[model samples]
Target: MRKVLLPTIIFIATILLVIRLFYLQVIDDTLKLKSDNNAIKINYDYPERGYIYDRNGNLLVANQPSYDIMVIPKDVKEIDTSEFCTLLKITKEDFLKKIAKAKVYSPRLPSVFLSQLNKKEYAAFQEIERKFAGFYIQKRSLRDYQVPCGANVFGFITQVNDKIISKNKYYNSGDLIGRQGVEESYEEILRGIKGVKYIQKDKYNREIGSYKEGRFDTIAVQGKDINLTLDAELQKYGEELMINKRGGIVAIEPKTGEILALVTAPSYDPAILVGRQRSKNYTMLYHDSIAKPLYDRGLLAQYPPGSPFKILTGLVALQVKAIDENTSIICNHGFSFAPGRFMRCHCHGGVIQLHRGIYESCNTFFSTSYMRTLDKFSDPSVGVDVWSKHLKTFGLGEFMGYDLPTGRKGNIPTSKTYNKVYKGWRWSSKTIVSNAIGQGEVLMTPMQLANMMATVANRGFYFTPHIVRKIKGQIIDKKFTTKHKTTINRRYFETMISGLFDVYNFGTAHGLNVDGIDICGKTGTAENFTKVDGKRVQLKDHSIFVAFAPKDNPKIAIAILVENGGFGATIAGPIASLMIEKYIKHKITRKDLETRILAKDLQPEYNRFISKPIRDTLINTKVTIKEKAVVTIKDTSGIKKRTALKP
Candidate 1:
């Protein structure tokens, strides 16, 4: 019986071993994958990125053929290193360093050695690529900008870093990723899936045939094309108007909340970030500390809203029934909230109503209204919180959740904010009276200001402003389409709208109104200040303006801010009017205004903050521009310095 049991156990063990072998060979493919890895070389086929078109179907960005030099460290064979380096226009040290980096990334995987070669360079490299055993040329596509504008909107692609590779499994060494703007926001949809082919290799590293007859191969899928809400003509025109200027301009469609033109001054050509010279050009643009061309002022720069803020003050007051359209406040050149403190006004001495208050930009009237609204509640903290809530309804103080990757949630101070500032001391509306005039801690981005204007146009609601109108074969996120209602009642906006309309009829912005267009606008001049060697010093004021055209059924809402441009009427107003006219009328009737703005150079005003030596060095440095209207600056010493001023 013991002998029979031993023989039976041995037979069972033999049967189990046979079953395991069958499973590994027929059912499970893990061992097959390992075997294939040893004898197969995988190559990726990158598909062309989808084209980008403006709302009017004008091509904004298209793909151009490019080549990347790829390396496989384990497959490298000794060759003429000098000839290879010369052919690729790289030094021997650089080649060695790239090979070392590729090895560190993965000795078996392909890594980009050099990327984005032009046609001429590609042709030259193709001739000598066969001489290098481990190196190969991979075809890819880079952005070919149809126009030179919208660098801030279009963004650029760059090689993924190690951190990115570690975070995202889809990316490998030398893969491209979007850096900012729309590209970064919609990277997944824009960068299509990469196809792969596995080629079998012999022990001598010679190509034998396709691995497993290409059963595991995949075909690349092209990226989905997108249509942006921008108007290419308007974007080009706005960029031209912003020549020699350093600021931001944002225009939104009131009804749709689609961003029309987002212009940032000192912007570079998008093409500069596409080719082999991208790193050098990007470094220059990045380190130009004075201009900060890489900074998206439209979505990032926060500043005091100035007079445009008065509109919100009036709206909040009206919503709380603290003030009405008929409510009048007298201006004796200013209002005295405290014994020795006074808030000054620019309006003529007289009794002013809400309508007149907006157009005249009456400091005394708005301050009094702000005080009355806050004083209505017994506790100033509760009142300030309520006021803050009202502002938040307008999408102020918080990130607007726009479809961009970069933005700032402009400050909207609450009761808690003031509590910290006052440090437990008793305070009232009088203590924060400067806030009544859009000064103090109230800050907003140009995009926020434009959205505020759009809210006013919608009479208490707004759609989240977005760049892409539609994605091919897909619906946009519902967040962009959802209506965001402000705290103010819809009826209250009419009074403010009437006041804004009068701004064009007889207020500060009257002089810059477009012919036959009922433009409702508010002008603002935020006092600029900065710390110069640890002392707060006053700088030239920043000009600001916000407006919506056609008044009733508004088509466009826009906000413009010009740093150190003096009064809002002087620079910001005219620029907004021109932009509005260009967009609505599709032609410029104010040739004189256009000519003056085109010729005006404010570099000297900017230079006061930056050292003269630095300014001199930057002068006469040529920056590439497209769509004509390029200026050959002899000296740009006076433009406002971004580093010299603080919000």
Candidate 2:
């Protein structure tokens, strides 16, 4: 029985091996063609990248014809090197380096010799193409920006680096990929599949005809067109308003959570990164470290939210039942949490209810409410955590999961966050009452604040803010469509919304409103400080504002921050009102506001902080240095990181 079993096993193994060999030889030719690399010349058909359209179907990005000189390093027959170098506008040394690098990449496969050539250059090179053996011009499609703004929104495409090539077998040395913003986040949907074709080559290393009668070839699929939520006209207007400013503006559709416009000041035109000058222009933009034109302040910059944060504080207080709409507190021009110490306020002293507290930006009302909230619980730790839990539900203290790639989840302090800072020191609501007025450890990006406004506009629930409105022939991510409800009751928002509406009527932002629009808004001024020559100096306040229009049925919700722009009503409020008007009415009725804002440039204000020359301040503070000096002082602009101190 053992001898029979062994013989049967051997017989089965032989039969399986014979079937596999037959299938490999007769049926599948894909692996066979790939193995025969020496006889086949492979070419990739790069598809046209997807077109980007605004939500209203306006074209934001389209394709333009361009060319790249591709090289197969081993197939070269030397020609007039000097003439080739002159036509390509590259030095002889650069030619040698490029050829050597191409050879290092692969002698048989194609590599990019010179990329992003314009039509004139392509035509001139094509005239003398027959003279060079290994090089050929490959026709390509490059990004053509239809508008002048949104450089950060539709990020530029560039060649893949070595790291990408090593990880992705689908890409070769010369392939292009998206690097930031919507382009990076939706790369798979925007960059369609590149087709492959294998042609039989002769002994001379010249392509003859299709291998295997083109059975293994695949057709290039043009990238799927996408509709971004941005309104092109609104985006352009926002950029114009922010021309000489140093901050950002973010607006979202309250009902859908679609990002309408995201503007970061000191940005460059997207077209500059399209042709032969891309590398040079990009280097210039990247090196301008002070202005950071390439930096998307709307998505990346995190700053203490200032008075606008009080809106959330009011909501959290209501949810915790620490205060009601009718609850009133008397203000003596400030909040006195401890003896001989107080946090100052700019509001007129009087009896302040929740409505007047928000409109006047009162510090006393919120501080007392915050302390009462913590005292409600047996331990302040449990109380603060509950407060933090409510704020997190509003998309604060975390990334909002927006479609754009670059961002920071602004810090939201929990009890543990303070515990780590205090190191077991005794603490309570009075210890951190500055948080009540939004001047403490509460940091948020412009995007998050905009989302918070959108949440309020929606009454209780909000969809995750997203840049993509639609993708051609495919559904967008499900997460964007899902609703996220807050921990607070829906009815509580009406109480808060009424207070914000009066902010435009009788409060800090009373003078900054558009006629014929019922705008509910909050004005903010976040305290800003920086170090200059080893001394911490207070800079002008950062102006901030958050608002939604038509109060009852909202459309656009916006947040704007103007760094070092002083009070919120001066800069951020006007910009937000103008934006709301532009989006809703489609034209400007307040030419006075438009003219005044357009005429104002905050560059000189920014220059005062960042443009000072280095010198020994101990001797002559304003003198520029021309000679060697002892104890050279450097003026730097940055926040000194620390927990918010109690008054």
Candidate 3:
């Protein structure tokens, strides 16, 4: 019985020993496999970014190969720390701090020490690359800007923030993303699908072969090309024309609503945001107080239309049946409601026809007409509300749904808004007489104003303004092709257009008329400024002009604003006229006009150009501190106080 019990105990012990061996070798195999992976895995692959292009098959943005020096705390080998720090031009303290941070970020994963290294830098490192184990270079792509000045339109790509990553699971840390404009709005379309390549690594962190013989690898697909309606020459010309000006110009085709040219003065070259020197250059340009070049004034600036508002009021009157084509309104220089006070007109004709009223921009005619339209309704506010609604349909006080991201919803006071502001139960035309002349609370973007002129040119209907004519190999959205209908009758626009034609022939915009090409236009000098103290400071007026050319079949319609440019007829009108002539004739015949416009020096407020001297002056002012404290600087006698440091 004793011999049998002893044998049973020994058998149980043998079974326990075998179970322990199985647990250690098989059950814990995952941990061993992970440990093996860490030993051989060194390099990481960076997915390529998408490409961008213009409507005419021109490459706008593309990717160029870049390299980043990275460090993996766990995988680093024995090396001369001093020599490595000197080669990288980094301080020993900075190197240690980076390594410590990298450990916290998972010692297996690499962290970037220097990003977007140039060819020279990469070549320097390539000479001694194999010596470093964990501190290897990772290949990537950086965005290259071609047509460099359209920063606001094309926007920029920046590192994805924590907020961005949290918002979208697709984005990872260190990923570049579109920050503004078309880049932001069409991110999905522009950002193509990323591809992955599986690589097999041997021990000691050396790549052995492609995993699965490249079966699991994916070839990177290129991004779709975007086609814009922008005419490169026209846009550049407009920008040059507005060099010293403080406003914007928006030109659009009346038939297609495709923007031909868009310009906002004080714009930065998009090229400044590309490559390794991007952050430094951006900081310098961004903080520039004078130019304020980064601001996108084209779609974002909201200003009173001034006298251009009268054109819409004329259409509104005609739409409401309160005025006819030959309807005459007597103007004794102004419209007077009370005993003495009157809303003044700027030197217009007397007893003018509806067409002549528009041609001469007869303020009294519109004021009386707008008042009559309001008189038709029981509540005066209802009539004004109706007028506001019609204006909204014209793309005023609302977004124009452009291809570019940035846009301001210009203010169009609603009945409810008026009720809240005025605290009144009722309102009348007299209460809102300023709107007749495109003043008071009425405001609109240059693009919106351009579309309004396009609508007038189309005779009561126009296409919605858009920047993209067509994306390469892709169809334009139906919304852009659809026409926007206004309240004004088709017949009314004919007479109004005829009067506008007469304006270029015989009225305010006469100075800018081309003999063969018929141009219809309205000039507006908006009075805006305030006195803070006893001294009467001269606050320059905004020069505004809206026009369409070759009246029979209007090809191009545009709105121009020269902020603080005093007279619209002299400043903004001539610019629009010149653009029309250039677009239609394919050249500017009026050399005299060009010379005068270019040479004419406007006010200080209007002048915001980044002259070469100013740019150089700003760049020279920047102080560069050497990264290495050991590097010595020499100040040579007879040499300008420039400090020369070791590279």
Candidate 4:
């Protein structure tokens, strides 16, 4: 019995020892594994990007599945160098360099070599994929721009760079990010949540099975879809009209302030920047300096509004109570500001009413009217400040706050600006006389000018101009959709509108008038300078026209700028009229006028055109007599990229 008890005690001691050993080996194993995993394994998921569409439900930008062949440098082993290179269609030296780059980037992270492979290439790689242990395909999506209407406005997407990642944690290496335009503005909405999936692997590093049957996996949510305000047809036509021309056109609904069509010349297919050939095409576009097709001239260009600016001057005079509809001023073909200085005007006028003055674009009347408005102010500086404020209400000297990301805050000088330049507030009435006639330091974007015309057409209010009408299923926010009021009085717009109608019917833009449509318009010829070898040279004048059709309940308010166009009445005026006529009547009527206008080739380009010094004492200077050319109608088949240079 004693011997049995001794044996039992030894067995109990043995059991106790085994239990302690189990605690150390089994329980601590998890802690050690955790530390090991912390050193090696890191996981990431891809996020889905947003979709884009036009107002009509036509897909503009979408996504297409793409694949990248990635490699884990350290994990790669037993790779048949020659065979692998042959399959990948790469040389041995190239493969080695790529592997070296992968090591430099990160060994644990997958490095990409062949991206956006075709279906055939992908299939061939998939068949032999198992042989390559550390190599795999990373599924991704690339932008597929179906239509390239708004290339600059829509922008593009590219892999996030280090700078972007440093700025925002939402992005990391290999993340897709918005590069410009709407994509940047609405990044929050367009960038969707990321999805994740995990699978257990064996000692050979082969994926065994799902960890928990996808229970812990998160599904990707699609990004919010965007709907634009662009009328696809009109945008297409507008682009066609501006073909070959170096200028831009902006048209908006006067009442809603919704941009109908915005066209910039030297445009290209936006789709060219997407898919397999993306990098190649992008490099080409980036280096093309002659066309600069990527530049968004519509929103970025800050040009003198020319005659289109007269609309604002008319509104300001009436709003300031400095002029009435019947207010009359005389013009002797020019405005005499001082003894030797004179502001030139186009032919025709002797004591004309305020309405007729605007119709004829009489510089003399505007100079006097502008002086009267300034004189009405209590102080000269105060008057300039007040005048600038009024202009701001019309969306000048500021951004239109359009949905588009690109825009310029055009210059509208205040008294402070003038004082900074010329020093002190001691300047007299003639100091800013040019502002009265839409000249001097004032500059406006085509978008701003278009909206201003819309404000005049709507009588008092305009909506914040936007290219997008909705995003996904949600309508564009109320802040931009709401109507915005200008500083001009409600009743003051009619006089301006009536005068514009007369301008189209009998004034400078008379060639633009249609038989049935009461087209309202005003023309401007702005003198600009060209410098050659540090010498100022006289260049051709810019032809500009602002117009709206039907005159009442206007549908389109448009601003047309033809780079270096000789005369507003001849070049810009006819082009604008053709667009209006095409939109309203669906055809061109005045073929003779259209043919003649198209035939008159504008000699110089915008960058080359210059303004000459006006003869201080010269009179009846034979004015380089321009003949009124006629347009000839033809089938609109090849009308795309028609070049009509407006000076």
Cα-based lDDT for every prediction: 0.87, 0.86, 0.75, 0.73
Locate the minimum summed-lDDT window of 10 residues in model 2: 623-632
Alpha-carbon TM-score of each model against the true structure: 0.93, 0.93, 0.83, 0.83
**lDDT tens readout by residue for model 1, 1-647:** 99899999999999999999999999887589777787788888888777899999898999999999888988788889888888878898998899898999999889998988889988988887788888888898989999988999999999999999999998888888888988899999999899988888999888998888887789999999999999999998988888777789999998999999999886778987888888876765665566677888999999998989999999999988889889988899988889988777899869999988888999998898988889999899999998999999999899999899999999989998989988969999999978887899999999999999999999999999999999999999999999999878898888789889999889898778788999999999999999888889999999999999989799999999998888999889989999999999999999988998887777777777666645565554453433221222333465542221111
- The list of candidate 1 runs beyond 4 A from truth reads 1-25, 28-31, 619-647
Cα RMSD (Å) per model? Answer: 5.1, 6.2, 9.9, 11.9
TM-score of 4: 0.83
The candidate with the higher TM-score, 2 or 4, is 2
- Model 3: weakest 10-residue lDDT segment is 625-634
Which whole-number lDDT from 0 to 100 does residue 255 have in model 1? Answer: 94
Tell me the tens digit of each residue's lDDT in model 2 across 380-403: 999999999999999888888888
- Checking candidate 2 for backbone clashes, the offending pairs are none
Task: State residue 256's C-alpha deviation in candidate 2, in Å.
Answer: 0.6
Given candidate 3, what's the lDDT at residue 248? 88
**Compared to the true structure, candidate 1 yields what TM-score?**
0.93
Identify the runs in model 4 with alpha carbons over 4 angstroms from their true place.
Answer: 1-50, 81-86, 89-97, 212-215, 585-647
Report the alpha-carbon TM-score of model 3 versus the true structure: 0.83
